[model samples]
Target chain A: MAHDRQPPPNPTSQSGLPLRAAYGIEDVPADHRASIGILPGEAPFHRGCFAQGYRTKPWRIFQLSGYGKPEDENERIKFLLKTGETGFLMEHDRSTADHLYNVDHPDVVARREDVGMTGAPMQSVRDTHLCLDGIPIETTYGHAGGAVVQHGPFALAAYWTVARRRGLDLASLPGTGQSDFFLTYLGCVTKQQVPTQAGLRLNADIIEFCGEHLPKWVPVSIAAYNGGDTGLNAYEELGALVANAIEYLDEIRRRGRMDITAAASRCGGVNFRTTMDIFEDAAKLRAARKMWHRLLTERYGVSDERALRLRIHVVTSGSKMTYQQPLNNIVRGTLMALTAVLGGAQSLGVSGYDEALSVPSEHAHQMSVRIQQILQHETNLAAVADPLGGSYYVESLTAELERRAWSFVDEVAAQGGFLATLDSGWLHARARANQIKEFADEQSGRRVVVGVTDFTDDVSPFVVDGFPGVNDAYDVALERLRAVRRERHEQGARKALVALEARCRGSANIMPAMMDALDQEVTLGEIGEVYRAVWGDWQTPELV
Target chain B: MTAGQRRILLVKTALDGHWRGLSVVAHALRDAGFHVIMGGMISGAEIVRAAVDEDVDLVGLNVGGHTLVVERVIGELRAARPQLPIFAGGVLPPSACRRLGELGVETYPPGSSLEAIVDAARRLTQVHAEPDAAPP
Candidate 1:
């Protein structure tokens, strides 16, 4: 099976725009006068989000920290904090946490050695407590370790339960929980997650719950980073993100539990990925803010300027980092970070050089932090907001992305909505189509990723025998699950589980019942058991 | 040359569902005329069952977890069908790649080209094509 491939001799942008020799007056005439008058803080905010960008609030250095046992994750968080990390994201073990299984579940037990490969084993609240040990939850803007939709309620409730134990007020506490459909349904599809319908209900419940209490918490951030990394192009990423937001807002409206404007505000904090394409991706951030503002105003009639402002967090593309010359990824990480920074991101996480191999080593984690730190301190890049605001090339690209993204959103709309696309594998087909092209592009030498496709020779002295995380993560997690099962009040746990099962089968909010379950020290797998019984499993669409 | 299509079984040994890489490989192999059976994120026992039951000439394991798990899955596959030619590609670190290579399972870590993977698949299935070859 050979391909009669046509190698593109000339350079084109990742979004398929052929490069021009130079952009003079023809790119955008009158671009610098009236259109450029829209400053950083103005409406249709493609320029920037804030009046003063990193000057007022520097992008949060929020590298995800986890691995090994609970305490190991805690130690790593503290280490990151001491090493100039402004914020931390708790990462729950993917096998146990993402699937909402305990270490003892038959599925998890099959490959027990892989239990803590990605993150800490946060089965019960006790384990969550251990993961959050000594970390200042009151002051810190932390991610509560629930990246999956089904797992979000448990993760948030457990974190809030700990905050309550410390006598902190819920209204004033600041943090976020990512009940992202992209992570759950698209990027890393778990074995048996709740269907996307159930996921939307869970996320909407979180939004309403957060509205009443936990006012400062960004309940469910739509992380299009996962979608982009999975192979959605720039405009597609933007389109899918907003389309995803509409699912949440419409669900909340259907419930009629909270104000639509308030719901829009709660879900405004979004995440995008910055890849190697610096100008286009930066323009994507600009386009994203503009699209978000328009979506809130035109659709929902959101009048609050603050509610209209979309906060952006950029996670540098992990799949972009090469495995051949691992150290070369440091430069890749730095460049992606700069792309995010130049795009006026409110937060950033550079993928560790050893990202493809395993969880970050202490050194790799430090390097991730240093990359952000260097951008913030040494580089004068953050001195002004949207420094590339008036550039004819950037503005043109931003408008082009906005035009394409809206059309993508409309395509999603025609297929019912975002969740419908996931259910029907429509979005997956789109991603796979792009994936084929990307691989073929590289195969035909149209794309030259250094050390992977073109510069195949490596002469570096540095040997990054990728970090294999803690070996005892499984053993420790198994013991802890057993101990937690043994130590907690059996009756209280049973009572909580029964009540939780009732809510899952009924129409009431799942968060209150979830909080009760967390209060009674119910294990993640127990809640998972109830969910599986009540909701059954999501019939995952044919992926390949 | 084999008269029928060269069948290849691609299974994710670990439960983690990072299947984008696996999907691409499966697509590439299918394009190259191998009968690619996606066994999905299944257990070791299930993977072995699929390999033997499907009578695949080559097995591609998407290692989303530890090499130890992959090693155990490979052991199961080899025990079930001693003549099977196995290969792996996923989040395999340098050491894990070396470890799997020692066990005669070719490793394609991240950034591996589709051309190389397809070539490896053809070569591996060819090596395991005949019935009287030395046990792998």
Candidate 2:
């Protein structure tokens, strides 16, 4: 049912901030005007991070790649790398990895056919090794597959153990472990997960361990992309992200072991999502950096310039990709990728054209890389950093976003903090409200999604049926789990698990024991058992 | 119209818990005056049991995984209750959609509007308002 009424004269940003037809110097807020002249690479880096943005270092072409067996995922990763992907992200099966269950778990067995539909099932370090078989660990920047909170230690330990096996120094290893709260608590909540408090402790332990040993590794990335894609608006995404960071930094400071600046620097490598709202999202990124700088200086009283500048990895919003005319998503991907470049992202992953249907096929994955390649090579879009910095409209919108975002941050803080809000389901309620509003907007014709609403008919001959990951993932994973249990030294495995359980029980770091456990072939389910026994499961807040 | 009331059982065939689509559809179904039972992430046996126990007129399976699992679930449901119509949604590829359609299940993949889904629910369950009943 299309709306017959005329549209309102004045429109607003996606976050509900009103916009004027024209903006001038008067429209730019006074406080923001002072920083308007500030250059990239300077303090409070709203403009950008590096003065010579892509010229000095082009944004890394990092794409999420994984599914099926470990070998199958490795093949896809190799394909992406050959097609000019600068970095690779390993994704683990949600059925196995997100829940920390082995292939034989009753829950997984019930859905055996769905085992590796989302990502590879790496139940043990051997499977992780197979996933990284030919990939170079020392030089290439890898994202070890631990997107879930409870799974982070095992994934990171597996990656590190593999590196050590290759005789690589832990200090020189560079990769990111995504133990993000937004993913764990809000976006894709697993059926069973450690409580938020336990998750915080695990993340702190990872950060501390990384600081002491794997100095180059990004201990944990705060992916607000999950929050945004799950339905938090632009301003709320920024505010909630900052709130999450505050929780991490405050915990680290309370421990009083590691220096806060290093902890802040570790937290700097954050991720955000760019949607079809190009200008607003680009403005959101700018506001994000500035808000991060202000948070560090104002709240924590830290002056390390390196720690103030937030590094961003933008993944174009997958929710924006329509499933109707799947080919149209390629253009959407390009536009969103351009926004990320305009926003001065350090790295970017374009959501595949078939995102609405399934994980990217080989062709769709290549198209994702090609879209970034075209932007980086053909258009010269990366020549100047923060290209949208000076325009009156963009500047005004950026300042407005920053002001509103800070206020939202204050609101979240007033409600006890990010994790508390998540535990209380307050954030989920906000996201659900936005989801309803957005859906209603589409239904009422206020927001017309092409192909879905307006252009319903398709004339193209090509059919996009989505990627069908290998059928044998479940069988192979089950065989490998049996092999690991049978071949590994049973006594050593039990001892390592006992040590890990002790570490989990006490206040000490759990990584060393975790590494030993993985090295001894302690399967994922056993570790999950230990966690369940010690910390217990988080009571997932109710959501419709 | 049914004599007493029409009910629909919504269940997830896999363990993935992203509920944005399911929530919208459930709200629309409730608004349209259907009894909506949310069966969160249940097995094929559990789904069949729930369908029989709740006496649902229709079954909506949120298929987020392999078609084989969904096919099996649909098979079990059909075996248990021959008359219960089934519809599916969530990340189903075109091939999977076609396969499910072959099994007599209407498929609403991503990008299907809430109105279309609600209309599908009504049509599938054959639940229409009585002239004397109050408006929704």
- List RMSD in Å for every model shown: 2.9, 3.7
lDDT (Cα, tens digit) per residue for candidate 2, span A62-123: 99999999999999999999999999999999888888889899989999999989899999
Q: What is the lDDT of residue A498 in candidate 1?
A: 94
Which of the numbered candidates is closest to the native, going by highest DockQ? 1
TM-score, candidate number 2:
0.96
For model 1, the local distance difference test gives 0.89
Off by over 4 Å in 1: A1-8, A29-34, B1-3, B129-136
Q: Which ten residues in a row have the lowest lDDT in candidate 2 chain A?
A: A1-10
Which residue window of length 10 is worst by lDDT in model 2 chain B?
B127-136
lDDT of 1 by residue, A157-246 (tens): 999999999899999999999999998999998899999999888898899999999889999999999999898999999999999999
Per-prediction fnat values?
Answer: 0.85, 0.73
Model 2: residues with Cα > 4 Å off, grouped in runs: A1-8, B1-5, B127-136
